[model samples]
Target: MVSDFRKKKLLHLFNKFFDRDGSGSVDRKDFEQAAENISKLRGWKQGDAKYKETLDTLLKVWDGLQSVADANKDGEVTADEWVSMWEAYAKNPSSAYDWQNQYCKFIFQLEDASNDGAIDSEEFSTVYASFGLNKDEAVAAFQKMAKGKANVSWPEFQELWKEYFVTEDPNAPGNFIFGRSSF
Candidate 1:
């Protein structure tokens, strides 16, 4: 079972980011929009390889979400469904969500625009900003996760990403992973 706190955090992430276009549920359309936004941010025009790759990866991410979260097979993931999926993952993270790990890897690679093996606050903020999160909040989140460091390495971000999904502590830096949840 998921704690109320965890539910709140997960729902906040879904509503603020994944539920793009305020659809109230996440579907392939959200992934498409997200891919477009990210590709545009990367300055990869439509029909470009980078743009196509982003779309493909995001679609794979959506497929993973559908497989795990869309219990009804309705092609969309509701808030309840989303929270339930997290509950399952939290109970057995090691064995579940290999696709999610891939998504994280893609995001990390996307954020490391400089390809320097680490992600800086500017890079973090820029990518998150496309998700409609406040730039200032993204910066604060970077600070929280980076813990005063100038940049965060892959291992550190992996831990932070896991914590963001599983931890219920409001004060944990991972809570800011999606740029300051409303709850």
Candidate 2:
């Protein structure tokens, strides 16, 4: 189970992702818009192969989240449902762990711009920039993960994500994955 502090931080990040319209709730349209923005960020031009691939992956993620959080099948995730979903995850952190593993897999595909099956420094920097990190901070974090390697493979990144989300160690390289968190 995550500590209270970490859980709060996770919840904050969850809300940030789900509450896309600033309307205090998440709907199907919000998911579509978020997917569109991510597709654009990945430089996917309309009708391109990667564009459909990336968009499909993102929509799958959205569907997964909706399956978990949309209790009423109303096509929207109300604030209450969102809180309930997190509360359930808090009680059973393994559920969150599994969800995060799938999330990371999707992110890996999206961030691996070169289709190399791994993330190089440049790709890692793109991810950091998306999270609002500066170049120096992103470089430092990537160096820590590199540990003499030129890239981070999927398994290595899974370990990093586990550490980042499941551990409280202040010095964990995964802590820097999301840039500087306000929490």
TM-score list, all predictions? 0.93, 0.72
lDDT of 2 by residue, 1-183 (tens): 346656654555555555667786777677667666676777777788877776676667667778888899987777667667666664555556344566778777766888888888788777657644575666776777666578888888777766666556666666545543334
Scored by lDDT, model 1 comes in at: 0.85
Report the number of the highest-lDDT candidate: 1
Residue 11 displacement in candidate 2 (angstroms): 4.2
Cα error, residue 172 of model 2, in Å, equals: 2.1
Q: Taking the tens digit of each residue's C-alpha lDDT, what string does model 1 give over 1-183?
A: 888888888888888768888978999999898888888898999899999999999999999989888999999999999998888888777766867898879878998999999999999998888877889988988888788899989998888888888887787777766666335
Q: What lDDT does model 2 reach?
A: 0.67
Off by over 4 Å in 1: 181-183
lDDT score for residue 116 of model 2: 87
